[model samples]
Target: MTPTAAPVLIVEDDRNVLDITSFVLESAGYPVLTAMNAEEALLVLAGHPEVGLILTDVNMPGQMDGIDLVRRLRESGNPVRCVVVSGDALHAADRLGDLAPFLAKPYDRRSLLGAVQAALVA
Candidate 1:
């Protein structure tokens, strides 16, 4: 049998947030991979070429933050779209500038899903 494709990868250090995001995406019928940090996220990305979208938290435990991770990927010619979720709404756009869209923390289900949909279709 052919393996299922994973279209989205969620990188968040917070366990609860990760679980909730994964559940939400799964409920929407999108296959997802979860990673606690950028390092692990790279591994998941390497393993899942089908992943076309990345939902990540700006503040993470790894040396490379979410923005940096996305920057690296873009620099390396990886076309996977990224959406950054963070509590720091005031400057997330400035910090993440041109890398991807920024969704402030405490986002509602509609906002979250909407951002994902927009990024995917962008």
Candidate 2:
């Protein structure tokens, strides 16, 4: 564990998953930030510069989608690593883009934590 546990930002429109994921990360010893969409995510990221990882869904109801969020994050030269999880397999390839270690939805707890660890470690 780090002296200051890395903040993991979880962006998901689904309220259940958002809360569950936040709880998962929190229990795993990672600081977690929850957002319903890209707009809210941006607001959270703006204040907490310690954010070291992102776990987002592909489809979200907001001004910017998860792919756009990751792309924009990269465009801004932020080092925060990303893990895009979605139920849509067809869109995964395109949406994942340069972001590696993507997970399909309904992911197991181990897989989720593994992905988070990899992203944060990266």
Candidate 3:
């Protein structure tokens, strides 16, 4: 697949949130992959080089949260783009800096699609 058409890897512990996000992205014609936490996300990324973007929740039940996951990816020199989503937007944004775009939780379809599209092009 082309870079823009590459799959989006979503890391979310909440099954409902994961399902909704996947549905929205897939309905918009983007390929989707999912992991429940950062560890699973890392494994998925290692196995799927075609995953161009990561849309991850900030909080999860794992050794590494979403921010840590992005930091790990960056520290390891992975160039895949990322978008961080959280209900606690302020805290996440403060820590995230320019690492990735922040999309607040309870995001509507339009906002979610907009963030994903922007990150894909970025």
Candidate 4:
């Protein structure tokens, strides 16, 4: 039998967004891990190094914002792909350049899934 695919981590402060993201990705055949903040996300990542992708919202409440998380993870040379989602379009877009791919809030489900696929490839 084939092993299951790696889980996709969804880190968004909004419960609804998290739920919907998890639902969408899981429905598309990927397992899901959900966290509300960057710190919790880091904890999840520490335990699940096999996670294939991280979908995070930039304006999370706490010390480590999404951009910081992306930078840190990339610096550590982890293979986990990242996609930063935020309402601060320009600001977040600027920060994602070297860190990872990104998607804006209110994005279409197709776009979200597309980003997930691409980030996983990154």
Put down candidate 1 lDDT per residue, 42-65, tens digits, no spaces: 999999888978999988996999
lDDT of each: 0.87, 0.83, 0.94, 0.86
Give Cα distance to truth, residue 3, candidate 4, Å.
12
Clashes of 2: 0
lDDT of candidate 2 at residue 109, scale 0 to 100: 81
Count of steric clashes across candidates, in order: 0, 0, 0, 0
Q: What ranges in model 3 sit over 4 Å off?
A: 1-3
lDDT per residue for candidate 3 within 29-66, as digits (tens), equals: 88999999999999999999999899999999989999
How much lDDT does candidate 3 score? 0.94
All candidates in order of lDDT, best leading = 3, 1, 4, 2
Q: Please tell me which predicted candidate would have the highest lDDT against the true structure.
A: 3
Worst 10 residues of 4 by lDDT: 1-10
Q: Can you rank all candidates by TM-score, best first?
A: 3, 1, 4, 2
Residue by residue across 12-90, what tens digits does model 2's lDDT show? 9999998888888888788888888988888999999888888888899977888888888888988778888888866
Question: TM-score for all predictions?
Answer: 0.92, 0.91, 0.96, 0.92
Backbone clashes counted, model 4:
0
Q: Candidate 2 vs candidate 4: which has greater lDDT?
A: 4
lDDT tens per residue, model 4, 1-122:
11348888999999988888888888888889988899999999999998888899999999999989888887888878888999898999987786787798988779988888877665
